[model samples]
Target chain A: DTAVSQTPKYLVTQMGNDKSIKCEQNLGHDTMYWYKQDSKKFLKIMFSYNNKELIINETVPNRFSPKSPDKAHLNLHINSLELGDSAVYFCASSQDVWGVSSYNSPLHFGNGTRLTVT
Target chain B: SQQGEEDPQALSIQEGENATMNCSYKTSINNLQWYRQNSGRGLVHLILIRSNEREKHSGRLRVTLDTSKKSSSLLITASRAADTASYFCATDHLYGNKLVFGAGTILRVKS
Candidate 1:
């Protein structure tokens, strides 16, 4: 079973279009996060949800929104996608907020969703 | 904006050699973690060292953290071709639930 999984590993859409990426975690984690990896391979945190509550919201554009239906699922919706949004979107989960578990408390990431805006 | 920055954007080494990667970050962190990504695949967590701990090891991977210097290093002994991948260091700040990642280091192990 996958610890964290995302749907539509690859997505291609025209500009001004809307898209959504779904994520689920089976590891029974309390905190889930969304990250964006740019062409430079720099990973940045976009949003974090703890038990369905928004905890961390970075400087990402308002066009991107994260919705957590439950502790096990977190979905990202982008409105009027732009060319700059073409990057790999990753979903990750951690057992606790501070990662107090040490070595075994690392985040579990899903295979990223590669989004392309034409 | 507590981002970890990894040095040597890319590295190349022959098989059976040792590979070492370094990461430095700004601000205090609760823990530092290292991850490996195989091409387009998802990142796999390699190791994590807490602020209270100085060193840790798993298999062929060794991680050392220097909280005073806000730096950490990952060393892989007896590197093999299969170990070719992108390595990233992430830091969890003391106040947040997010992990800020660094610009990864792409390691290439030639046979």
Candidate 2:
């Protein structure tokens, strides 16, 4: 089974539209994250939740909000998207927020959702 | 604020050859990790090396961490055509809880 999965592998929407990307992980992880990769392949963190509690918000715009209904699922909802919002969104999970603390803990990522705003 | 920056944004090598990518971070880190992402796919975790350690190996992948220099390198031996992908270096801070990723190095392993 796929460890982590995100819905709508591809999304295309007009500017000012609202959209949501759903993510779920069967890895039984404690922390989940949302990342955005631009055309230059620069990956940036958007939000992070540790056990369903918000732990990190990397100066992301208010229009981009992350919702973690539970520890296993985190969804991103974007409102009034702009041209700059076009990028690939990836969902990732880790056993704990700390990396390599106990036996090389690393982040497991989903295939990613490519969002395009025109 | 980028945590890690990888040099030589892209590299191409023939199969069976070794490929090395370097990463430099600005902050003190608890651990460094390497990930591989094939075209049109999510990234796959490759390996992780703690700040207290200097080197680590897993199959054909070798990772080295230099805490004093705040840099790391990932070397893939006997690279295969299937290894053609973008490799990224991510760092988890010693005091912070977030894992930050670098720009990434695109590797094209030709057959």
Candidate 3:
């Protein structure tokens, strides 16, 4: 099984439409994160969840929300999507709180969901 | 803001040759890591070198971190076509758990 798997590998929707991307990790990690990669390949952090608790939230649009139901899953929902929202979203996980497991914690990332808002 | 900036946005090499890519960061970091992402695939961790460490090696990969210079480099020796992919450098903020990535370097290895 994939260590980290995300659904809807390719998403295409019109502006004003709402969409959601689902992510799950079987690595039994305590920390999960959502990152957005633009066309230029600039990867930016959107949100991070440590053990189902919100730990990091970047300056993203309010229309975007992250929900972590359990330690193993983190999902991202976007409302009133705009053209700028078109980017590849990646799901990732680490063994634990990064600083706590500093040396050995390298992220495991999902293949990524390519979302497009026309 | 993107914490690290990768030089030579793209690289091309032939099999058996060595490929080197460098990354520079703006803030102090606890550790620096290298990752590879193949076309249409997820990123895979390559190696991690702690701030206190200078050099680390794994198989065909070698990573060096110079905290003083706030720079790191990844060297892939005896490169194979299969090693072709986008390589990125990621660093953790010295004080927090936040990990930031750089604009990746696309590596093309020809056989």
Q: Number of backbone collisions per candidate, in order?
A: 0, 0, 0
Local accuracy of candidate 1 as per-residue lDDT tens digits, B1-111: 588899889999999999999999999988889999999998999988889999999999999999999999999999999999999999888765567889999999999
lDDT of 3 by residue, A2-113 (tens): 8999999999999999999999999899999999999998888899999899988989999999999999999999999999999999999998686676554889999999
**Candidate 3, position A14, lDDT:** 100
Docking class of 3: medium
TM-score versus the correct structure, for each prediction:
0.95, 0.95, 0.96
Kindly report which residue stretches of model 3 are placed more than 4 angstroms away from their true locations once superposed: A102-104
DockQ per candidate: 0.61, 0.61, 0.73
Model 1 TM-score relative to the real fold? 0.95
In model 3 chain A, the worst 10-residue window by lDDT is: A96-105
**Between the candidate structures 1 and 3, which one is better when assessed by TM-score?**
3
Residues B13-108 of candidate 3 have per-residue lDDT tens digits of: 999999999999988888888999999888999998888999999998999998888999999999999999999999887776688889999999
lDDT of each: 0.92, 0.90, 0.91
Ranking by TM-score: 3, 2, 1
For candidate 1, what is the recovered fraction of reference interface contacts?
A: 0.74
In angstroms, the error of model 2 at B13 is 0.9
